[model samples]
Target: MTEVFENSASFASDLDSKDELQSFRREFSIPQKNGKSVLYFTGNSLGLQPVRARKLVEEELAKWAQYGVDGHFEGGRPWFTYHEHAKKGLSVLVGARESEVVAMNNLTSNLHLMMVSFFRPTKSRFKIIMEAGAFPSDQYAVESQLKFHGLDPEQALIEISPREGEFTLRNKDILQVIEEHGNETALVLMSGIQYYTGQKFNIKAITEMAHQKGAVAGFDLAHAIGNIKMNLHDDQVDFAVWCSYKYLNSGPGGVSGVFVHERHGDNPGLPRFAGWWGHDQDSRFLMQKGFKPMPGADGWQLSNVNILGTAAHLAALNIVLDAGWQKLLDKSRNLTAYLQYLLADLGKTFNDFKVITPEKPDERGCQLSLFFYRNGREVFDFLTENGVVADWREHPLNETSERAGVIRIAPVPLYNTYQDVFQFSRLLKLALEKEHERITE
Candidate 1:
């Protein structure tokens, strides 16, 4: 049976009262305004910090102080294997074997490493296909990789874009591009969920299509990880990478992670930029190095793990693992749906904005990106002034000079309650009405 959603504070409070994971909200330190918790909704940008994160970092500091260099091997959570602490949680979240996942490197750096092994561009198959408006960092990485291979991006890059009048790309269109360029495509790298539109691409289907075209398939999960449940192992994704600061609630620039399918993880002969830490553990101290990599994703590490950063991540990871990944996803869908329903209802009488994120729960996550047709900047500023911590962007609409402002609101299930969503809708309605009055007067 379809659940009927109502736009009322009492209804929202009732939903919050019944939420099984409501207790988890106390685990985070929500930002304050006017001596009350702000309507925090930017989890897609930077997640609220976990209450335990500070102590986790301090513990690592104390360990370093006591053990000195010996901390590498002598501490409770030794720095030598600090990255290992994250594997269990990372594996469960991304749906890969622990051996196939590793906590290491930033998102784009890992992307370059994966490309080194997977994007072996040949004379006939040299084109790299991707979404046109991928995050700029990914775009720069792909462009540089092509140039490094002496291939001009104009000739070697295929960027699939949304169709006319559409804000998101169609799956059929994406598949069609892969098939059409099957002979020439060497790699297909895409965002698991679009950063701007909040559209969750079909990782399994995209991987299947890339394989059909004899091209390597990989994803940047910076926006998808911790926000959505993935089955990358069963889906046979070649590799993937993501940062932990957003949905994972780790601090800013926290250590990122990578997933290499068992197929590639087992292959040590794969070409990659090597480093000392990536060497086989048993022989790492021998220092007479031929550079034998640790098998699986651990083989990709380029430096001694950043103990402090990984500690903060593990602190946050503990909360999600306790909450259960599936349970968090369940609440995420409902929170996004309630917000969507309420916003759509408001649109009936006040039609100034459009929700551009995919309507299907399966095709999106907790985020809803609003494309304002009028009074966008004013309304967004008003929300910010009123303590709605949201994200604002002016993204390209199509292959034209025109662009539109987007306000992204992500209600993270771990720390956000239904009452928070209710309060946001209330603020949004007031912002809109106030803006309308100011313009008319």
Candidate 2:
């Protein structure tokens, strides 16, 4: 039975009072204005910093000062093996074996690195398949990879798009496209959760489809990593990459990671752009002439670990772990659903309001992409000014129309509260009415 929702502050506060994970909010440093914390909902973009990030970063700095270059081997947490520290944390998040994941370059760079090893195109099978509107960085990476192989992107790339009148792709359509182009497809790359629409693709289904077609399957899990749980290992994902800045609360442009299936990760002969750091650890410092790759995802490391960046990442990862993965998952589903219910109730009064993100919890993560037919930007700005932290994106209806815009709101479970969604509902109602009056006047 569905519980009745009351659009009241008391109702929301009561939910918070019953929340077992409410104490986790203190782990993050929430952004504030005029001495009050803003109602943060953009964790899908840049998450709030973990409170321990500063201290962890300072500790690394102290190690550097006290040990100088010796810090690489002399510190409490040796810089030479710093990236190793995050592997276990990342493994649990992505549902991969510890040996299959490693903290490394930023999101895009990791994509390029993964592609170098996974995207081997043949004359007969040279095509790449991906979601139509993947984040721009992934687009550029695919385009350049195709160009490098002397293949025209237009001819070698297949982008799965939404149906004529839809904002999200159907799983059936995605499978059909993969099947149609299976014979010629070299690889399938898609985001685990689409950034713009907040639709969580069925990674296991997509991976199985791609493999059945004999194509390497990979994913960019930037939005899905911390917002949703997935088993990359059991899903048989060939390779994947993600950034820690979003949902993971790892700070802006935080360190990224890659997941290489154990089947592929154990193969030292697999072609990859090698760096000294990726060489066998025991002999890495011996200045080996030949490349001897480390087993698993560590073989893909391009350079020595960034101790400072990994410090922040590990600090954030610890918080997520301490919060308990299943507990956070449960809270995310509940929080996003509560907000969804309230938004739906509030939207009943505004004919122009529409939600483009999928309504099913199983089809989406924690985000809701809201569309406004008119004064979208004005209302977005109004909400921003009134302490609602959300994201804005232009989704024009036509070339001549500016009225169609969207606000991407992500109520991250780690620190966001039921009270945050309650307050947002109230603010949105006012913004809609105020904008309507302003337009009429």
Candidate 3:
């Protein structure tokens, strides 16, 4: 069936007609190029700002200016427990109890902190499981953690790879790997959504399998947190960490959140890198001599909260909570499906394009990774020239080959419209066609 989209104008009108979250587009300050808003398809890289983020930040700045040291005690709103304000909202997004969630540090930093307590590798069982093509930061953090434990990464890290000629891993293959080496694996740490291929892993199934094999289960939820519903507690994941910058709409390098299972709440014997912020608030001001930790994830915080950052996160989380993630997710699934439909049609009309993201909707998130068979770099440059914002991932297959990368177009539901996806599809087709003409000439 024909897509029925006649022109960009028709698509725009259709977008105007059906956008349930239309008001949210005004809630962000979108980047513009050449006097027009760029067709942004890179929310998976960094989400658009919430209109109220500045105001929230300003509020913290005002408090700091008015009361420097006093801000921690008696400033208006009191910065002492400011992190608690973001707790309820962050918890909701990750599907954990409020006590099980806390916001602090950046993504990789939090990953390291979580590892300090959870990554206990013994002589007999001292291996970690993860994807071979994980984000560079994650890979580096894991490698460094292994080294810190005095274990060689080559010996302690079990990196899973897809079979030849495939972009995504099969769930069965992953399970088999876990079963084969489960007894020797100390921890199973993997991304809830694989960054390069836009593949959403089966967190629940994997966690269950890892636990059955006596391995602790955890996740790097950087790409999964806001893009998908992760019931961290119910999934029985030992622990998980995620950043707020991407789908969470918390701006660049936003504070990260972590989840610790309720089972660990009363386990005071668990080792953690703690600080005054993690101490009991009732006695924290008492300046006690001994270390006394709070219960659950909050006890893991190493220092005072970043008020401005947490405020920005709260500003965005408020919108998420109010919008109802279920509705947003429903829209997200359909919007991505629509984008895929448009891309598939483009494949029939153009010979240069193919989608590398998983074909099953349940197997991926809102982003679709598209590979251009020829002139991929030229096509990317052309897309940028035409005012469309997308991201290209570094290819692990050929670290030196820049042309072998894929363009990632993430159609975020909070701010992106169907028209934006339509425009991206059109622009990509035109760019690929132009590249083909230039190459043939």
Q: CA lDDT of 407 in candidate 3?
A: 89
lDDT at 299, model 1: 92
**TM-scores vs. true structure, each candidate:** 0.98, 0.98, 0.96
| Per-residue alpha-carbon lDDT of candidate 2 for residues 175-253, written as tens digits (9 for 90 to 100) | 9999999999999999999988899999999999999999999999999999898999999999999999998888888
Q: After superposition, how far is residue 274 of candidate 3 from its true place, in Å?
A: 1.5
Better of 2 and 3 by lDDT: 2
- For residue 202, give model 1's deviation from the true position in Å: 0.6
Model 1 Cα lDDT, one tens digit per residue, 1-441: 127998899999989889999999999999999888899999998998999999999999998899899999986788888899999999999999999999887888888888998999999999999999999999999999999999999999999999887889999999999999988999999999999999999999999999998999999999999999899999999999999999998889988899999989889999998998889999899988488999999998999878888889999999999999999999999999999998998899798899999999999989999988665888889998998999888866533323357899999999998888888888889999998899899
Q: Can you tell me which runs of candidate 1 are displaced by over 4 Å?
A: 398-403
Name the regions of candidate 3 deviating beyond 4 angstroms.
1-12, 399-402
Instruction: Name the 10 consecutive residues with the lowest summed lDDT in model 2.
Output: 395-404
Among residues 3 or more apart in sequence or in different chains, the pairs in candidate 2 whose N, CA or C atoms overlap within 3 Å are none
What candidate 2 gets wrong by more than 4 Å, as runs, is 1-3, 396-398
lDDT of each: 0.91, 0.91, 0.86
Error of 3 at 43 (Å): 1.1
lDDT for residue 283 in candidate 2, whole number 0-100? 94
